[model samples]
Target: MVSPVAVPGGAVLGSAFAWGHGVNLRRLKYFVKIVDIGSLTQAAEVLFIAQPALSQQLATLEGEVRQQLLVRTKRGVTPTEAGKVLYRHAQIILRQCEQARVDMEAAGEGLSGQVSVGLAPGTAASALSLPLLRTVRARHPGILLYLNENYGTTLSELIMNGRMDLAVLYGDKAIHGLSFLPLLKEPLFLVGPRAMPAPAQPVKLADLRDIELFLPRPYNVVRKLVDAAFVRAGMVPRVVAEIESAFTLTAAIADGLGATILPASMAREVVAACGAWQFQIVDPVIEAPLALCQSDHLPLSEPAQAVKSILLELVVDLAGTFAATPEPELAALS
Candidate 1:
């Protein structure tokens, strides 16, 4: 009997049918389920198998791969580093297999499947969620569009994990196992209560040093950009509150709690709704970058591809609407 071949990262590559004994896809599914549920007992119940049988399968998988996948504990199990690597690859593999089945079934039929798209919250992209839903519904009546509005980092991670098809988010940094298309850049603006004095000209970073500000947490993409801009100008912002919800932020601005920094489009909305004042941030204009993120290796399903095309077209049409400057040079798969 041939033995499974282990790669540098302790991932089993080939099986007996090929060059060496390999972990079968069924076992991979079991392992993935176990990891996802974080409890073999729960996984067995979900998979409709006996607990002992599930344990035996996991043991066999570990033996074949020659790497311990889960760290079993009293409460639950967690994937080790090697287990995490396997889990990530397993998600992609399972998604690809499912996509293959779906593709075959819908070969002659029109595009008809669920496609998940994420839009980063607190950015101009969030405004596209409803438009995308409407467009997909109008063009492909059979297709269902699932939209998620969340943090850029969270959205990007979902795309990387194969859980989400695509995302419009802030950031252009190249991430492993992910591809990015730089969409456009929107300038930052300072939004404050109407009760406060409004600046006639674009406000410099230094001008904001003394003003009380309400901003998202430091991990937020827009917050990071705002923080970096202030840091470069040799000052720190006077943050009165760290707010995550747009409603709460707008309410605070309306109540004259403090000012906040936001992308041009979002700032405009807040200003309009809250009867606030907005001035562009300049003297080294701070612009927030937005990009389209997707899995670098996974081929998009037919429905997903159709939705992506529509999303791209929508972005182009709404670029000016969002006060976003289109990138002259588009980077493909960056």
Candidate 2:
């Protein structure tokens, strides 16, 4: 048999399989390595096995499982739906095996492993990220923790794509092949430059008709909510700029470009970074629900499960404080 060519990541697995036969650990390891490296030839070289031999093993495994685990193309390989399912299970199995070994080696020591989590910018700003990291670092000194901050939509995509083990997302937007645990409901706030006087009272979404605003694209969860409210209020949102970066949005607002809507906690952070700003509760009392989300198909490793538990406890503690106060103290914010 000829050596299979190099395949890039995301190459589609074009075949189907009947899930009947059991897969061996050796086959699983080979399959996972190929999926991770995105190239059969590269995985074979790394495994110190002949390309043809590796290919034969993969073919045999596929035959036993009766599934096409990967789609091969000139550019690279992509996992099919079935392949993705197998890849997730395989990852958990492999990780558990490694973690078992590590635990054995560190028997008397402490838990030692790696956990990577993604967080949306708002969730990160809600006074969760730093505390989570600090607590994990302090308590599980041996556990390696990685944090990736991005938009809620992006974070969900990362979690689904297997790039992130888990993420805190907004609105519980239904994402396919994922599970969610509701965390908290955060009240929304309108943030504007410090130079702008505080609104006399809580501003209504309808009141924003004439105001210039800087917001993320419509696809963004926050923006989508804001847009829906505007539509409900029969107001035409006067968006002056479409900025995807949270940092850029804050900078623009500070420069007096326009105001934006965000969770009260996140708005406070923006005000602190961008200069003086008015943080007003929306009249209709808009609230964004956040949740801890994970892939339904991907099993959480022990370390990841530990981190998730820690995160849940921390969010409960913090959210309780926010819940006690409908509106954060505006005076103290300034």
lDDT at 32, model 2: 90
The reply for model 2, stretches above 4 Å from the true place, is: 1-22, 80-85, 103-109, 124-126, 157-165, 173-176, 195-198, 295-302, 320-334
TM-score of 2: 0.78
lDDT of 2 by residue, 1-334 (tens): 2112112254433233322344566888999999989998899989999999989988887786677879999977878877877786666566667767876886878777888787777643347788998999988888889888877777777677655777877757666667877666777788888776656565777677777888778887777878877777777789888887767877888788778877766777788897856555557777777778898776776678889878876775666555523122221222
RMSD of each: 3.4, 7.0
Global local distance difference test of model 2: 0.73
Question: lDDT per prediction?
Answer: 0.83, 0.73
Across 150-265, the per-residue lDDT of candidate 1 in tens digits comes to 88888888887788999999898898778988888999988999888876576878878889999899988888888898888889989988999989999999999889899988
| Model 2 / residue 283 / CA error / Å | 1.4
- TM-scores across all candidates? 0.89, 0.78
**Candidate 1, TM-score vs. the true structure?**
0.89
Candidate number with greatest lDDT: 1
